[model samples]
Target chain A: MDMKEFKLNYYEKLYLARHFEDELMKLFADNKVVGWIHSNKGHEVIGVSLALAMKSHDYIVPHHRDRPAYLAKGLSAKSLLAEIMGKTTGCCGGIGGELHIMDVETRIYGPTGVLGSNLPIALGIAYANKLAGNDHVVVCNFGEGGSNRGSFHEVLNMAALWSLPIVFVCENNKFVEFTPMQKHMNIEDVARRASGYDIEGIIADAFNPMETYETFKYAIEKARRGDGPTLVEAKTYRLDGHYEGDPMKYRDEEEKKYWLERDPIIGFKASLLNESIANESELESLEASVHQVLKEAVEFALKSEPLKVSDTFKNVYA
Target chain B: MTKINFRWAITHALDEELARDDKVFLVGQDVGESGGVFGLTRGLYEKYGGWRVKDTPISEEGITGLAVGAGMIGHRPVVEIMYMDFISLAIEQLANQAAKTFYVSGGKIKVPMVVRTLAGGGFKAGIHHSQSLESWFTHIPGLKVVYPSTPYDVKGLLKSSIRDDNPVVFIEHKGLFSLKGEVPDEEYTIPLGKADIKREGSDVTIISYGKSVHQSLEAAEALAEEGICAEVIDLRTLVPLDKETILKSVEKTNRAMVVYEATKESGFGAEVSSIISEELIYDLDAPVRRIAGAFTPIPLGDAEDAHFPTVEEIIKVAKEMCY
Candidate 1:
């Protein structure tokens, strides 16, 4: 967990997630990848940094925009690509497509399609851990828009009142779908709402992986120490449109340019070079390796067979 | 054999399962110190403590979602929805999450959980507290729907539900809570999808479950006094329905009647009647009849009695086929 190693790991995962989304966008345009694609282009650093702070056995109930989180949890890129391609070799055997990618073996509870639905599930998993006399924490990820859901309030209250070992991470990327945060709610920060639940609310610079990692690490440790849940709000922006095919008419030019200038990957790379942590050549090699990994993932997914129609009825029961 | 009330039979099943497996735990509103709204989980919190018999917030959706997650992690969680009507709040968790988790996970996960709720309208608890919604869970795949009538059936079916590897919706009639029935003292379990023959006859067959089974049995007795033998088949489980027992009874009697406490429109009895007509069309001597609750909201007071099918109505339906 040295700075050099952490920098490399963060850059590698971010590159993988970025390239994965890029490839998915291409495939989606060609109609090779089915279903709606929620790109994690700008939110990668936030998801990956938080994921890195979690233990292997600890549960991660991910939001739909959690490609980097899955990569950080060590799920095979080929399996995720295969899932997007609706292949039998996918993580869920192609039963759940882009919206639902789950791996029980990795303790990644998968992404919930419904807004804020996984919060209670994550709280329950933490409850189970507490009941079993374990200190394992559960991390529940959702967007700023999902914070308005009743489940958000219900789960937070339960988790706080019971002193459950869990962390609620809200990736506040400004806009929720097509609606901006201001239009959705009057509050400037979603974390401020956590005070009502009697939990500490903290905000982090989502574009900075180091900041997100350190913040989530503290929150996760506090949870594992039986200190109850903490609400961490990461201020970031969605680099791309809400979905792959979203029209860009709703967003203005200046707002988009402001976020693009502070793009996490470019900023992190500049920091790595300026701090003399990694030379330009080393960063180039890391980027090349990530490209190779994603190329092979796409190849594996393309070569995998699509699930048969008969497979639909296979797991309907035990 | 020992005689116990229906509620105790359920409590005994919970106690046994909690003792049998360390992973089994109960979560619901008022299930701990208050012993549940209906006292169904009485004495459980005292024996197992608060950790096992947990009292949760009045959030059905939250509790159900929590149980689904715990079940995915190899814990058998039995969630109690205070009333069957409130299950509407938890349909997303139960139908979308719990019922689809196993299938959507591609067999990677199993949601071994039970949602215990009370149905029927005999107590006059009004619209919110009393409603027969067993058909809702029966319609969902990846979920087992169990509605037992007698204390013996409730004990056995509940044990089977806890051991089941899929999510099970166990519906107990509110009116049948204090009904007494003979249960075996020794350890035993009745398999799901198996129908129980409460009474045997030959003239006609009456298929029902839950509180309706009692009415059907009483109607059969009345029919027997009039020299018209009506066989009664209590369908223990609805989803994994025992079509074999139902069809066999219909084939022998050549007359079938489906009884239920829910509305007639798209009720569970319609499924039974359809099955009888589809599979045993040639075995019937008369058109299959369904005696169900009136297609309206269950009203309060004595008006609720008119909403549910009475023993007299069952006897009349049986006589219509007998003549």
Candidate 2:
């Protein structure tokens, strides 16, 4: 795609994610959603770029903050919204809710609530691909706080040791739940931990979609070439609270303002306009299109059937 | 039929399954080139080569999660956690990931994986190596817990577990590894959730599994000498427990005694006792008696003898229930 078209496409994804979260918050307030929705409002570019760069066969094991990744990976907003609303039409038939929504058809492995548990599970998918002689790679995403988990360390060493085709993407939004990055770990960069396993580590400014996309492309291609795993730390911020209802007492106003100024969507929008990649009319049209899509998604989710009691007991065994 | 040791029975099952299905692979610490710490996976590594019979680093959680992940995408992975005690390190993956994936995914993914681990007190392997922690897995739904006793049951059950489309926790008794029993020359597989009547009697039913099954059989023999007819039931599979066989035996015998190698509190035997009393309480002539290990952590080597339930203890429980 040309630079103009690429920027427009990136802008569309960013707006869709921002609007998705914005509408989701309203739904939560209206009590239409079940469980917590870890909003990926600011870090949209990190997951969206990775999804954009990923191939059809490549698997993505995304975390709670990666709802945008699912959208970018081609999961319909209708299915995703229905999943969050506990409707039968959801991705996992409403069994996984928002926290654990997964669609095997999209090659999307859902996350476990147990912090970094998906790292090793994603490694398994990569391992299976390698054994099958498939060049497909798995992009396993986690937060900086999740990097402190033993699953992170153990999975990295095993992936490197076996030379599995996998990429570990760390979205360093600083806070791990209520704890800050510095308080949780002494290291500033999660990618630096990759050196312990003798793997390549790269850092990218996730606020810039071009940089995030290029970084993921390099790491993903390197993994597909069977050179082993790479840790790509996407530097970003949690524009919203950790969860929907998290109190903002832990974060200072100045720090919040600093991250807010660099919010990826705003930065990308300014760049698109300043560079003349897209006109004001074009950007407004894209925003209107995203709003229309989300409106339909909400209607579809609201119209879908609610989950029955038998649904809970249906899949206990194969 | 040919008589073989329990360890070789397991090896034969793995070998046959690895040869029978291309999707079947073994990955665990020292399982490949090293032939496993117990030499159970010895010849298979040389036979199937490194890819199928792969060895792993000493990361129980990693390998267990690997098996679960691999199984989720159609690979039949049999991961061994050298000792059941080390399973504590991987319980999060086993219980949370492996056990729940099929259900959470609404049956779209089938985790056809087997976690084979050695558990029992006779190995003198200290608290970390010697533990009958089957009840911990039995408590988790979506996981099939199998504790086989005889060589025949091990070979058949291991083969069946590999073929099953769910996560199976196959716990082998370390004490029974050297014990020999007749296994058929022809290919055979014993289905899960089926209890075998090792010895039949009308007076009392002795419910047991794993190493305790052997003790229960011995106890039944002694009970026969003492004029107390005790029926010995070997619960080959613990999760999809053979409730029919247990209930039928207790109903016919009218008295039940549960014997197990695990601790007395909340052991798998307790589940069996509850099932018997819940379903066939009116048929039972006497209250169910439980003979199990001491509540303490398994002691070192020979000291495990005192902690583990002995044949005399089973006999005592059986006599108490029967008389």
Candidate 3:
């Protein structure tokens, strides 16, 4: 895709995610939505860009804050909203709420709430792919704090040793559910720890869709070619609190302002205009279309019926 | 028919499964070149290449999660945790991820994997190596727990566990690995959740599994010499418990005695006693008795015998229940 087209598509994804979460926050406040939601507001580029680079058959194991990644991997916004609404039309038939959204058809394994739990699962998927003689790559996304989990180290070592087709993306959004990055780890970059497993590690600017796309594209391609796993640490910030209604007192206003000013959506818009990649009208049209899509998704979710009590015991076994 | 030890029975089961289905593979520490620490997976590594029989690093959590993941996506991965005590490291993967995947995903996915781990305390491998943790897995709703006593049961049940569509925790008693029994050369499979009556009598019913089954049988024989007929029922699977067999035996014998290697408090034996009491309370001639290990960590080799339930203890318990 050309730069203009890529920029336009990236802007649409960012707008859609931003708008979807904004609608969800409203639904949560009015008691329409039941469970807690981890907004994917600031880290839209990280999930969308990486997801855009993946094939339909390739697996994407997402963290809680990865609705954008699911959308990028072809999950219908209506289905995502319905899932959060605990409706029967949801991807998992309302069995898995927001934290456990899964679409097997799209090969999206999970959006696990457990901090680094998906890493090893992703390794297994990649291992299965290799054993089946398939070149499908598995992408596992987690937060910076999740990198400290034993699963991270153990899975990386296995991936490196076995040369499994997988990519480990750490969305280092600075805070780990209220704890600052400094307090959590001594290192400045989680990517640096990847070398301990004898794998290549790269740092990318998550706020920049172009940079994230290019970095993850390279890693994904390398994995598909049987070169093993890569740990890509995307530097981003969580614009909101850890979850809806989280006090978020640990971060200062100045820090929040610093990141808000460099909002990925705004930054990408300026880049598109300044670089003469897209005109103002083109960007505006894309933003309008995204808003319309989100509006329809909300409507679809509202019309969907909640799961019945009779079906509660349906999914407990095969 | 052929006579084989419990360890070789397990090996033969794995070999048959791996040869029968290309998707079935083994992954665990020391399972490849070393053929497992117990030699249970001996020779299968050479028969099927490294791909089918893999030697993983000592990462129980990682290996368990990997097995769950692979199981979900069309591969049947049989992971060995070496010792059941170390299952603590992989509980999150087993209890949370693997167990919940099928249920949480609304049945869109199924984790068809078997976690084969060595349990029991005769080796005196200390607290870290020796434990009877079958109760822990049985408590989890989405897991299938299997504990086999003899070579015939191990071969048949292991094969059935591999082919099962749900996540199964297959526990092998380390002490019983060398115990031999007659196994049919023809293919056979013992379905999970079925109880086997090794010996049937009419006085007191002794319900047990794993190594405790052998102990119960010995106790039953001793009781028979004294004209206190004892029926021994081996509950091969704990999760899908054979409640019918247990209740029937309790009703017929008018007495029930629970035996197990795990601690007395909240052991699997407690579940059996509870089920019998709850359903067949009026049929019992006396309150159910239990013969179980002491409520303490398994000590070193010298003190291990004192910790586990002895055959003599089972006999004593059966006599009390019968009288």
On the 0 to 100 scale, the lDDT of residue B235 in model 1 is 95
Score every model by TM-score.
Answer: 0.98, 0.98, 0.98
Ranked by DockQ, the better of candidates 1 and 2 is 1
Chain A (candidate 3) TM-score to true chain A: 0.97
Model 3, runs deviating above 4 Å: none
Residue pairs with backbone atoms closer than 3 Å in model 1 (clashes): none
- lDDT string for model 2 (A1-318, tens) is 988887798788878888899989999999999888888877899878988889978899888899888898889899999999999899888888887877888888848898899988998888888889989999999999888888888899999999999999999998888777898788998889989999999999988889899999999999988888999999988877889999968888899898888887888899888998888998998899899999999999999998898779888889
**When superposed on Cα atoms, how far off is each prediction in RMSD?**
1.1, 1.1, 1.2
User: In candidate 2 chain B, what residue range of length 10 has the lowest lDDT sum?
Assistant: B314-323
The runs of at least 3 residues in candidate 2 whose Cα sits more than 4 Å from the true structure, single-residue gaps closed, are: none
Taking the tens digit of each residue's C-alpha lDDT, what string does model 2 give over B1-323?
99999999999999999999998999898998989888999988889988888888888898888888888889999999989999998899889988888777766877899999988877687888888899999999999999999999999999999999999999998889899989999999999999999999999988889888888888788889999998899989988988999888888889998888889899887888888888888888889888898999888878879988888877777777766
Ranking by DockQ: 3, 1, 2
What does TM-score give for chain A of every model?
0.98, 0.98, 0.97
Q: Is the docking of candidate 2 incorrect, acceptable, medium or high quality?
A: medium
| TM-score, predicted candidate 1 vs. hidden true structure | 0.98
What tens digits encode model 3's per-residue C-alpha lDDT throughout A246-279? 9988999999999999998888778888988888
